[model samples]
Target: MELIRYAFVGVLNTGLGYAVIFLCMGVLDWSPVASNIAGYAVGFVVSFTLNRSFTFRSKGPARRELRRFLLIFALAYLANLAVLVLCVHAMGLDGGWAQVIAGFGYFGLSFALSKYYVFAEGAGHRDAGSTGHV
Candidate 1:
C-alpha cells in the first residue's frame, strides 16, 4: 500500500538523517543546531525523491511537487516542534520522550499533506498503478 511505502521511506530517511547528524556533530565538530540542519537538509531531498518516485508513483513536474513538499514539510516541522515544547515544558515529560511523541505528529502530518496535496492523483500528471517498483 501507499502508506506502507511512505512509512518505509520515513524509516530510511530517519536513519540516514540521524547518521548524518551524529557524524556532523561528533566527527566534524559542528554545533547541535548546525548538525541538525545538515541532517534535515539531507532528509528533505531524500524524502521528496522517494515519496514521489516510490510511494506515490507520481509523474508530476518535480519543481511543482518540490515546492508543495517544502511547504508541507515546514508546516509539519513547526507542528512537531510545538508538540515537543508542549510535552517537555508544559507536561513535564522527558525531552527524549517528548521528541518521540513529536515525531509521530510530524510523521502523520507529513504523510497526509504529501498524499492529499503534494502528490495527489491528477494533481499534475496521473500516477502509475501500484507496481511496487521504485
Candidate 2:
C-alpha cells in the first residue's frame, strides 16, 4: 500500500532527523529546540530528495518542486514548533519526550501537506494514485 511506503519513508527520515538532533544536542551542546530545528533542516533535505525520487516518484521540475517543498516545510516547521512547545512548555513534558510526542502530529501534518500540495504535480494537484507512489 502507498501508506505503507509512506511510513517506510517516514521511518528513514525520522532516523535521519534523530541522528542529527542527537549529534547536535548530545555532542555539540546545542539547546534542545535549536538542535531539533537543525535536525529538521537536515531531514527536510533528505525528505525532499527521497520523497521526490522514491516516495512520490514525481515527474516534475526540480526547481519548482524544491520551491514548493520549501514552502511546505516552512509551514511544517511552524507546526512542528507549535507541537513541541505545547508538549514541553504547556504540558510540562520533558524536552526529549515532548519531541517524541510531537513527532506523530508532525508526521501526519507533513504527509498531508506534501502529498496534496508540496510535491504534487503542477499546482495543488491531488491525484492520490500518482502522488502516493512508493
Candidate 3:
C-alpha cells in the first residue's frame, strides 16, 4: 500500500517535471541541461511534500525531513549520473536509452532512501508506521 502511494506520487512528479522541462526548453529557450535542472528543482519540492504526507504519512519535523530528503535526492542523482555516464560513455549505449536506465536506478535508490532514511518508522515525531490511514 505504501509502495503504491509512493509510485503514484512518483508518476505525478515525473509528469510535472517533464512539463516543466518541455516548457523551459520550448518557450524559454533554455538549454536541455538547464531545463532538466529546472524540472528537477520543481520535482524535488513536489516529491518531498507528497511522499511525506501521502506516501509515508510522516509526522516528522519538517525541517529535519526536508534536510534529509535533500541529501537523499543528491545522493540518488549522483548515482544516476554515474550510471548514465557509464552506460553512454563506457558501454557505448544510446544517450536516450542510457537516461531511461539511469532513471530506473534513481527511482529505486530514491524510494529506498526516502523510506528508510528520510521517513523511517521511528524518525518522525510519531512513528511513520503508526498512521492508521495507510
Candidate 4:
C-alpha cells in the first residue's frame, strides 16, 4: 500500500523534475548539475507533503521530518548526479537525456529512505493501530 502511494507520488514528482530539467538544460542551457538541482528543489516540496500526509501518513513534527527529508534528498542528489555524469560522459548521452535515466535510480533511493529512515514505524510516525493523527 505504501509502495503504491509512493509510486503515485513519484509519477507526479517525475513530471515536475523532467519539466524543470528540460527548461533548465534545453531552454536555459544550464549545466546538468544545475538543472538537476533545480528540478530537485521543485520536487522536494511536493514529495515531502505527499509522503508525510498520504504516503507514510507521518504524524511527526514538521521540523524533524523536514531535516531527515533534506538529508535523504541530499544523498539522492549526489547519487543521481553521479548517474547523470556517468550517462553523459561515459554513455555519450546529452544532459537532458541523462537526467531522464537518472530519475529511475533516484526514485528508488528516495522511496527506501522515506520508508525506513525518514518515516519509519515508530517514534515520529504512525504505526499499526495508532490513529497517527496529530
| Best lDDT among the predictions, by candidate number | 1
The order of the candidates by lDDT, greatest first, is 1, 3, 4, 2
lDDT for model 3, please. Answer: 0.89
Candidate 3 has what TM-score? 0.79
Higher TM-score: candidate 1 or 3?
1
Badly placed stretches (over 4 Å) of model 4 are: 14-42, 93-97, 121-134
Cα lDDT for residue 74, candidate 1 = 92
lDDT for every model?
0.90, 0.79, 0.89, 0.85
Encode model 4's per-residue lDDT on 36-115: one tens digit a residue: 98998888888898888888887777788889999998898799999999999999998998998898778889889988
Best-fitting candidate, scored by TM-score: 1
TM-score of each: 0.80, 0.65, 0.79, 0.66
Model 3 spans with C-alpha error above 4 angstroms: 23-38, 121-134
**How many angstroms is residue 128 displaced in model 1 relative to the true structure, after the best TM-score fit?**
8.7
What is candidate 1's CA lDDT for residue 32? 100
- Candidate 3, residue 11: how far the Cα is off, in Å: 1.4
lDDT of 2 at 85: 98
When sorted by TM-score, best at the front, the candidate numbers are 1, 3, 4, 2
